[model samples]
Target: MVSSIAQFQIKPIGAELHLFGIDISFNNSALFMIIATILVSAFLTQSVKSSYTIPNRIQSLAEMTYEFTTKIVSENVGIEGMAYFPLIFSLFMFILAGNLLGILPYAYTFTSQIIVTFAISIAIFLGITVIAIIKHGTKFFRFFLPSGTPVYMAPLLIPIEILSYLSRPISLSVRLFANMVAGHTMMKVFGGFVISLGAAGFVPLLFLVALTAFEVLVAVLQAYVFTIITCIYLSDALYLH
Candidate 1:
């Protein structure tokens, strides 16, 4: 029987390449990331190109996603945040596509990797930090200090708030990675049981189908949650709340 944990292993898929002493080898995770990017680009492009006065299914989906992302930005960051809508929109669709793609049998789930998720989270975290610093100048430092902070608690409060702020990437990355890994690993174990148990495996098989549907919901929800967090971060940067 194949080990359920083996599914999460990262193995090279092609001849390895090294650039400036760095390993840039292609792998299943990379392939799926490329595929996700291509598919997302194609879907959005086609949806826009074929859009009509009376929208069809694809057009409607495309428009709804657009409007949904727009609302997230406008509500969170106000008009000032509209400038970042493209970034937020791309993030939502990319994550949504990655999650759904991994649900397919034998497809590599890029978002399941902690490195990928952490990279995204950190990039957003850093970008928003830069935005706050650039826009607010030295006033950005006031975030850690916060309004109404007591004078006697400066040392304790400052460190605690700074630590909490730094934990954002860790929480964001782990949440996505842990959910995808747990859900997929459970599904794989049940799948293996179906093969091993033969006729009696129908019980696990039914549960597996239900789990797949649930995972799909999780995929969309995770994307939405991530985007919402992003908008919230931007709002804090813009409003210093």
Candidate 2:
């Protein structure tokens, strides 16, 4: 049986190439990311290509997802948030697709990598910060300290608030990375048991099946959690208090 951790390794697919000083060789993680992007693109685009008065399965699913994302943005960030709906929707679908695709046989789960999740989280964090700065100017810094506090409390409260704000990317990244890694690792361990036990593996096989369904739910839930938190951050940026 293949080692469970071996599945997460980033082995180059072909000739490894160096661009300047960076290692730019294509690998499994990159390949799976591309696949996820293509799949999401096709699903979103094709689902609405031929809109019928009474939507078909694909169209219905697409419309439902669109409406769901709209509601999320509206509730979390208000009507003005609709301007950012495309970004929010794309982020949700891409992460969801990546999580779901990783469940397939021999598929790589890039989201399991802390570096990958951290990178995405950092980008979102930076973008939100920029938006806040642009919209509120110097007042954006006030987010680190709540209003109505005493002047004497500034010394203690500012540092704590600053630390909390800086930890956003780390917390967001770790949450997704931890969940994906834990769920996938457990499934892999159980899968190994199923293989080794042969005929007696029926028990573990059943568990693996249930675990898989749970993972799927997790995949969707994590996507929602990540997106909603982003919306909340966006709301904070748009309206400081």
Candidate 3:
């Protein structure tokens, strides 16, 4: 049986290249990421290319996604957050596309890699930190200690609060990476059973169908979770809450 983890391997394609000692050669992960980006771009552009009073399926889907993201930002980050709508929207769509693309046969799920997810999460975390510092100046550090906390509790509470704050990116990235890895691994296991068991594989084949459907739901849900949490973080930075 093929190793379940083999599907996640990062095999380089074509010629390899290095820039300043860093290996920047394109690989399966990079190729699928590009595919996801192109697919998202094409879908969004085609969905909105023509206007209609009674929108078609594609337009309706695009509109619904737009409204959903708008509401998320409005409710989580308030009016000031509207300025970053484009960034939030792009993040949501890109992640959603990447997750869905990974569901296809032989496609690499870039989001499944902890490094990729962590890099994205850390960048967002740093950006939010910078925004908060710029907006509130020295007051940004005040967030490490809640306003109503007792002075006597400062010694204990400060460290806990700081640890939690610093762990945000780790938690965020791990959540996505873990879910993708677990779901894909389970699917692979069941697929092997389907092939190996032959006629008796019907049981696993049935389960595989159900698992695939669930994975699709997970793909959409994870993207929303990631985006909404990002909105909440941005809100905290904007309001120092």
Best by TM-score: 3
lDDT of candidate 3 at residue 141, scale 0 to 100:
94
All candidates: CA RMSD (Å)? 1.1, 1.2, 0.8
Candidate 2, backbone clash total: 0
Off by over 4 Å in 1: none
Cα-lDDT of candidate 2: 0.91
lDDT of 1 by residue, 1-241 (tens): 9999788788898899999999999999999999999999988888787445788888788889999999988987889999998999999999999999999999989999999999999999999999999989999888998789789989999999899999988998888889899989999999999999999999999999999999999989998899998899889888886
Candidate 2 lDDT over 144-210, as tens digits, reads: 8799989999999999998988899999989988999999999989999999999999999999999
lDDT tens digits, residue span 90-182, model 3: 999988988999999989999999999999999999999999999999999999999999999999999999999999999989998999999
lDDT of 1: 0.91
After superposing candidate 2 on the true structure, give the runs of residues whose Cα lies further than 4 Å from its correct spot: none
TM-score of each: 0.96, 0.96, 0.98
Q: What is the C-alpha lDDT of each candidate?
A: 0.91, 0.91, 0.94
51: Cα error in model 2, Å: 3.1
